[model samples]
Target chain A: MTFGQAILEALESLNGNKMRSGLTVLGIVIGVAAVIAMLAVGNGAQATITGSISDIGTNLLFVFSGGMEGGPRGGPGGGRSGNNDRPLTLGDAEAIADPFAAPSVELVAPVIQGNGALTFSGENTTTSISGITPAYFTVRNMQVAEGEVINEEHILGRMSVVVLGPETAVNLFGHADGIVGETIRIEGQPFRVIGVLVEKGGGAFGSEDNAAYVPFTTAQARLIKRGALDEVDVIFVQAISAEAVPLAVEEISNVIRARHRTPIGYDDFTVFTQQDFLSTFETITGVLTIFLGGIAGISLLVGGIGIMNIMLVSVTERTREIGLRKALGARKRDILLQFLTESSLLSLIGGIIGIMFGWFIAFVVGQVAAATGNDFVPVVGVDAILLSTGFSAVIGLFFGIYPASRAANLEPVEALRYE
Target chain B: MDRVIEARGLTKTYKMGEIEVHALRGVSFEIERGEVLSIMGPSGSGKSTMMNTLGCLDRPTSGEYILDGESVAEMTDDQLASVRNRKVGFVFQSFNLLSRLTALGNVELPLRYAGIAEGRREKARAALEAVGLQDRMTHRPYELSGGQQQRVAVARALVNNPAIIMADEPTGNLDSKVGREIMNLLLNLNKELGTTLIIVTHDPNIAAQTQRVIRLRDGELDPENNETIVRKK
Candidate 1:
């Protein structure tokens, strides 16, 4: 018989036991759906991390005072600056930005950050306040949605004009728009809002929107003046290009070491590039995705075995049919093809349904994340879809062979006598 | 008349755990094209084994068989299948219609196996009509009467126009009246289409209707009759 005719016969036989077929395919459906959903979650997290890191400026490195030990000091809400441990200063930032010192270094923005309660119109909210140079906006890709960004004049003159992050603008001024010229009190010091930053959403460093920006000179002279320590919390450095990151990191480390007169292996500072974090993140999520896929694959394997079990039962049940077909001139290959086709069709149908269900799961997850203020968008990779589908088909093929061969190898005379 | 089947000293033995059960022993027969014949025996007399050997379902342990001038003993399993498809048809006592397929679909089985693509449905319909089962074309086997199911089986046997039609106890499960009707149908096919019909049964009455009858006793030809074989004009 033609392969098409065998397939039609297979389908007809499967249709004869509709409930059994449905139950048999359920295992595959759950397995494939879990795989797809897991992949979606993994890819979505990777995309979100990549996007957030890119938002922090490409080819960038962060140099913070204090050693890599005991966690990151002078970080956000990190009280107690490393004043005794060779703290990074504004002078060091300038020296690193000098082309003669580090040619791979492109731009450096020194920042002194602290938390403050800003009061406006009798309403107050706690936010991180950072003193930065005019180059901070360009280096970090920060944009002003309204009014103008801090200029060199504001930095040199130690002006009190400030840029509010969108969230800060909305929190203090009750709205984000038309707040460019609003006056707000930072720790009882009056400051004029010059611009509101465009929203960039929440990420690894928490909401950038809840923060505020000011001129470095003003923050140094007036706000939280620590005498003689003259320390900046962190210095953001940009490399000339992505390829220059490692070179820039090495050069910056060398410059800081020489300038600090620190000995080898006893360095008091840590420099990390965005690439390092990206790769680390990728490894973590890649392993996680594989681990999840493996777990789901176990279920898929079980599903395949279930198919084999059912197929074996079916072959046994249809022994007489096999004999009858042989009597009707069906070759061994014909019987084998018919059973194989039936199993594959079962898996293919399950894969299709699982794909749709997985997509639905991802959509619901995305909606839930958004509802929880994460703004996370789940991405369903086409590779994941194709891989799972191809895997299931292979599973069906691999598992279907034994039973089909058993059916093919039946003795026609004995089989015809089977009750 | 062309010899549709030629066998010489066909022997088949079964070993039931160190005990040799000889199913057939030096049984030989030649059937002509378009001949109507019956193989008659009681249970355990090896008539079924003879039928299996004649149908090419099982190869003889030590003998030769030539079906339509092709060496059945030397052929591979695949070639045997091809020979079966091209030259042999089988009807079982159970009617052997696929329970899942409609009467028309069951009738189309041999043509499908023969890979006759065009005019398959029409030929199947005509075969069913020939068996007076044309109106039950879409009925499944379970929905049909035993007699109708048997007719469908007969139509399936004829659909590919095979050279030899082998029926094993064709009316063993049918009532006397339906069995007679089936016998008349087989006789009519032999007379009108010149199809070779071989029925294996224990019933002497059924064997009497055929032009030639061979009775087997304990894996050997019956010695009671002086006539080892019979021929008819």
Candidate 2:
């Protein structure tokens, strides 16, 4: 018999018993749906993380003075440069920021960070107090939401002016709207909140919204009390462009090594760019997405088994019909193709429906994430859809062979005699 | 003198566990082209076994059968199936029409199997018309009466234009009036289309209407019984 005729016959048989056919294909539907949904969620999470990390700064590098001994490290640039014992100095920052010393370094800001209790109008809260130059805002992509950022005068004159992060302003002053110009006592010294920073959510490193910023000179003279006159914990460096980061890192490394007079192989410092952190995060999330996709594939396998089980039962039920077809001139291959076609059609239909359903589910998830203020976009790739549909079709064919052969091998006399 | 069916000492044995039941024992017969023949016997008389052997649905344990010039005994199952498709047709006692198919669909089955692609529907319609089932072509088996279902079976048997038609108790489940109508239809096909007809029945009255009758007792045709009867009417 022709394949078209056999397919028509199979479809008629399926149509005859709609409920059983629907139930049989339901397994495949669920299998494909789970696979697509898992991929969507995994990819969405990866996208969100990548976006937030990039939002921290553009073409920036973090230079730290401490050595992280061994094991796989985060991509080579941004983190806490050092502790107080072997801290970076203002002179080091000046040398790195000098255009002739490091041609690719566009800007550098010294950072001194400490945790302190801030009391504003009898409301006390513990928060991170950061020491930075006016250039810190430019290097770290910070913006003043309510008032001015730290000025050059504030840095050189050692003024007690501070800028509160959006969340910190709300916490210390009880309202972010009027927090600018308010006097918040830090470590028993009163500092005027000159500005409130704009809102930015959490990133891979941590949230910046809970920190309060002050001038590096004021922090050095009044609060930290470290013995060294020019000591700072970290330095943020911005490159002229993204392609210049590697060159900027190499130049800064050479300048710092000369300033410290450190030996070549035992340099006590690490320099990492934002690109490094991105590659590291990509590797981690890529492996996780595949692991999740693999787990979802197991359900597709179960779905294939369901198709096989139902196909076998159908062969048993249609024994006499097979005999009749055989007697009417159908070859063994004809019978085998008929059953195989039926199973593949089942899986194909199920896969199509599952894809649509999976997309709908993922769209809903994206909407919910948006409602909760997260930047998650559900991405359903074409490759994912094609791979899943193709895999399901193969599953149908693989699971269909035994049952089709069983039907094909039936003896005409025995099958005809089977009531 | 053209023999459509030639059997030489056909033997069939069934192995039931350790016991062997001889269903056919050295039975020889020759049926000429366009001949009307009947094989009648009681239960366990080897008549059904002989019909199965002649229809190419089975092979003899130790004998030879030549159907329409092909040596069926040595043919593989697939080869025999092809031979059956090209040269043999069958009508079952239970009107073995696929229940899900309409009368037209059932009738087109053999033509479809024969790979007659273009005019299958037209040929199926003609076959159904020949069997007086043209009015019921769109009805399913359950919708048709027992006699009408048998007529659909006959239409299916004729649609492929096979050389021989084997009817196994074709009227077994019908009333006497309907049974006679089925018999008349088969006889008319033999007369009008020059088709070979072989009817397997337990009713002597049905056997008496055919041109030649053969009887089987136990596993063999009894020669001493002189059971080959020629009907003059």
Candidate 3:
């Protein structure tokens, strides 16, 4: 018989038992849908993380005053022992900023951070406060929505002026606008809000919108007096270009090592470029994506087995029908093709429906994530769709072999006699 | 007379789990074109085995059997299937119609297996009309009476215009009235189409309708009642 005739016969048989066929299709549907949805969610999470990391600023390097020997350091000022005692100071930031010493380093911002309770109009909230120079605004890609950012004049004069992040401004005065000139108390010290930073989304570190920025000299004199007088917590460095980052890192590392009087191998500092963080995160998220897809694939396998089970039952149930067909001069290949066509059609239909179902699941997940203030959008790539459909089809064919062969190998006389 | 089937020293041995059961032993017969024959024997008398071998459903262990000028005993499985498609048509006692198919679809099965794609529907329709089932072409088997279903089976057996038609207890499942109707339909088709007909049955009345009756005792032919009724042509 022709392939077309076999397909038609298969369709007729399947249509004759709609409930059984539907249930069998549903198994594959769940399997393919789970695979697609899981992969999309995993991909979306990876994209969100990497996108936020890239948003931190291009061609930038972070310099922390600690070696890599210690196990898993927390954010700055969580306290570390041993080689971490040597702190990065304002002098080191200035040295790295010098063009003659580090030509690839375009800018540097040394920062000292602390937590403080801010009160304005009887509304109180505790937030992180960072003492930063004017260069910090440029190096960290911070933009001002009103007034002006901390300038060299404010740093030299030790002015009690602060810049509020958009979220912080909203928390204090209930709005971001018209509050730039208002005065807010930080740890009972009255400081004028000279500027408000524009809304930048949350990042790998945390939401920059929830913090406050002050002049470096003011922070050193009024708050954060525990560390050495000129000690800074972290230094943000901007390279001339993305390609210049490695050279910039080398220059900064040499300058810091000379100033700290440490040898190359035993330097008490760690400098990392954005690429380093990106590669590390990519590896982690790639594994996570595979892990999720793998788990979903197990369900797909189970779906294939379900198809096999149903096909076997169908073969047995239609033993006499098979015998009749053989008696009607259907070749073994014809019977095999007929049953195989039925199973593959079942899986293919399930695969198409699963794709739509999976896409819907991913869309719902994205919507929910967005509602929770996350920038995650589930990514349903074409590769995922193709992989799932192709795999399911193969699964159907693989699982169908035994049953189809069983139907094909049946003796005409025996099958016809099988009441 | 043109010979349609020529069997010599036909033997069929079946192994029932290491116990050799010879279902057919040196049974031989010849059937001419347009001949009507009946195979009648009690249970365990090799009647079923003879029918199966004659229908080309099973190969003989030792014999030379030819059907419609093709040597069938030495043919491969696929070759035998091809021969069966083109040379032999079958009607079973249970109606053997696919429950899901309409009468027309059932009639078209043999033509489909014969690889006759184009004009299959027209041929099937003509066959159904010949069997007086033109009005029931769109009805499924369950919707038809036993006599009507058997007529549809006869139509299916005639669709491909095969060399021979084999009916195994074709009226076993029907009442006397329906059985007689089915028997008349088969005999009339043989008379009109000149197609060879072989019916395997235990009913003597059914055998009496045929031109010849071949009876078996155990695995061999029973010489007592074996006779060919000469038809006045």
Error (Å) of candidate 2 at residue A182 is 1.9
| Per-residue lDDT of model 2, residues A13-120, tens digit only | 888889999998899888898888889888988898888888876589988765554322322232333341245688999999999999999989988878899887
Q: What is the C-alpha RMSD of each candidate to the true structure, in Å?
A: 3.5, 2.9, 2.1
* Deviation of model 3 at A154, angstroms: 0.8
Q: State residue A296's C-alpha deviation in candidate 2, in Å.
A: 1.9
* Candidate 1 off by > 4 Å: A66-85, A104-106, A115-127, A143-198, A212-228, A240-247, A264-267, B225-233
Per model, the share of native interface contacts recovered reads 0.77, 0.67, 0.79
C-alpha lDDT (0 to 100) for residue A222 of candidate 1: 78
Give the interface RMSD values of the models in order. Answer: 1.0, 1.2, 0.8
Per residue, candidate 2 scores C-alpha lDDT tens digits across B72-187 of 99888788888888898899999888998999999888777777899888999999999987789899999999999999999899888888999999989999999999999999
Question: lDDT for model 1, on a 0 to 1 scale?
Answer: 0.86
In the range A34-90, model 3's lDDT, one tens digit per residue, is: 999999999998898899889886699988887776523324654344653578888
Query: How big is the positional error of residue A166 in model 1, measured in Å on the Cα after superposition?
Result: 4.8
Candidate 2 TM-score, C-alpha based: 0.93
lDDT of 2 at A394: 97
In candidate 2, which residue pairs clash?
A: A64-A81, A65-A81, A76-A272, A77-A272, A77-A273
